[model samples]
Target: MALRGTNQEFGRPYNRRIVLESIRLHGPIARGDIARRVGLTVQTVSTIVRELEEHGYVLSVREEPRGRGLPPATLRINPEGGYAVGIHITPLGIDAALTNLSGDVIESAHREAPNATPDLAFDLIGAMVNDLTGLRPGGRVLGIGMALPGPFGVESMSFVGPTTMTGWKDVSLRERLAASTGLPAFFETDMAAAAMGERLYGLGTGYSEYYYLYFGVGLGGVMVHDGSALRGAWGNAGEIGHIPVVPGGEACPCGNRGCLERYLSLEARGRWSGSDADWVAEIGPVFRNAIAVVENLFDPETVILGGLASTDLLERLAGSATQLPNSVSARRDRASPRIIVGRGGQYAVLRGAAALAVSGVLSPRFGQMFTAERERGRDLLQGKGMAA
Candidate 1:
């Protein structure tokens, strides 16, 4: 299978991204070291470095020579090189942030938007965008990345459903947000956005594949493979909220009985008054089964627990979880545990939303990686005088 990647182009752009990635991942590094690491000739690396410097994606700082020669120059990502606006529109409200090229949060704002009309929602987001971008003197906001509860635009789905945000049934979020904010918009399911957030800013940077279990007021997940979210048909791949964990438990808007979210989510728990012990016992089986299902289906290297729900609730769940059923991730010699607990909670999703924007501008996507490969193949053929 073609390795899933993104946002890279053939030739100079591809090389440029590599150089930037090196600086981003291990910054304040010298050009010669970068050339050695990325496997490029010194001259080629120098040319790309010069371009990066001219465009402001990198800043050069002088490094002391190890022993004798003149001090070397080091390159690091320029915090002001680029900017992106990340908006997380949840059932409760809109959370937004301005992130620099390095995925650092420069500024942030939040506005509650329960059942907010389209005009009101866009107005709030627009004002925040203006305020955020205003912080960066002359720096342009490249685009806006948004994450909201999903099954986006699905016909016959009721907006009044508990899992869905009200007043969003008739609105086209992408179009409205772009038009209102006057910037291009990218959209994702909240869980998907959380996964992207982790990938760019949290646990995801180290592992290429993992499952993100987001504990929004309800439960959901995002399957990330090789750093890109696995978008199922209709971009609703990780709608695990409706996964049937309770069989005959609770009536769900998705027309299922006993969805796992009913048992595991804070909203559902808030509806009852059982003791924590009794409650934990009731919820334990479902989470156990759900974790097993994730292992079997995704075979992720790690599973991260995140989202904007009760930390005590999630911590209890994570603490009580048992050894996973035999799956790809379960192994004896693994350096890190199969499961990772995320403490960022609500902020993680918001930061991840920002990461989506950062990713679009910074990450090397599969399309470009493939395009670069194709060009190389063409060059090989042309060198042999095989094809015009």
Candidate 2:
């Protein structure tokens, strides 16, 4: 949904996020334009902009008058206004990045912890957090965000399979990471986090609605609507990896035969023992089926494929995905490609992990006011979320 602001004084925080988002998306724009875009009065926009300027979050770009009375000053987000740390935990390693307000990575660190236990991962994460923080002289470190393999909180599907890390079934990542780093922590499934990162800082920008197909250790996807994730009831809505694609095909860890990931994931690619072209050809039908499923079910503006793989590999998949079966996205008036390779290279999830922290402080949510006071101390936003 398009962001709108309330005039109610109690909605100040919400309005503040709206104003900031306006500037982030459409700035260096005039105060008048922000007011019109967010449905706030010019007076309220002025007030919010002034407060943001005072807080060093918004920067005035042009103040010189053109002709008439004081020309409206265009505003933009201050790149140095804040910073956040992002951590991506995979079976192979943990990738960490420290990002500025504009999603630029200031510093990064990677440590391998193959099949890492929770304790070992936490220790490495703590060291990385310290290393990243030490590199920065001065800035507001908003918090930390983590992206992990998904199917979270389920007895059968969470943190137990070959694709996921073991000894983490009972670990409360948010609380433990927060206590360890002394900064509030947030987390999401790798797929959703990649989608969020793509939406905010990569090719998914300007496309309000899209489906992100994440090719990680396993296959996964996320649905974004109006610039927010449509996280389902249990927060594992996009576990497309486990969906049955082939009847009586390969047996998957999640107790399914012919799961999509069995034929379409990195694990599957690893098992191929063939060239990239051969792998692409092998999975072409399954990839097209997955795209058709995404298109028919979600009808997203576009489907973005990305993750811990090479750009060349993702490009190959994108090329194969174009000759798809009849789906809702097959339109003669299409303005964009049906499927495209994502940006940010392999750091998409890492950037998304950082975005979780940035979004918590700056992005507006629907029920934030009611929960803000209660959740202030916790700062535990999780999963594929709508807030960013």
Task: Write model 2 residue lDDT over 1-388, tens digit each, in one string.
Answer: 6889986654776787888888987878999999889999999899878877877787997677878897767999899887899999999889999999889999999998899988889999999999998887776787899999998888878986667776689898888898778886788998888988898889888698899999999988999988888889999999999999899999888887998988898878988989999999999999998899999999988888898888999999888876799999999898988998888677789889998877776677635533664356332222122221
Model 1: per-residue lDDT, tens digit, 1-388?
3212123334555566667777877788998888888777778888777777776778999866788887988889888877888888766778888988777788889897776677888899999899999998788566788888777666644355665676578777778988988875677778888787777777788888889998876678988887788988778778787777665888877677887887777667777699666777777777777888898888778788888766776677777776556776677778777677765556666667766656555554524433554667642112222232
Top candidate (lDDT)? 2
Q: After superposition, how far is residue 84 of candidate 2 from its true place, in Å?
A: 0.5
Which 10 consecutive positions of candidate 2 have the poorest summed lDDT? 379-388
As for candidate 1, its clashing pairs are: 5-365, 5-366, 6-364, 6-365, 6-366, 7-365, 197-352
What does the lDDT read for residue 297 in candidate 2?
Answer: 100
Alpha-carbon error at 3 in model 2, in Å? Answer: 5.1
Show pairs that collide, candidate 2. Answer: none
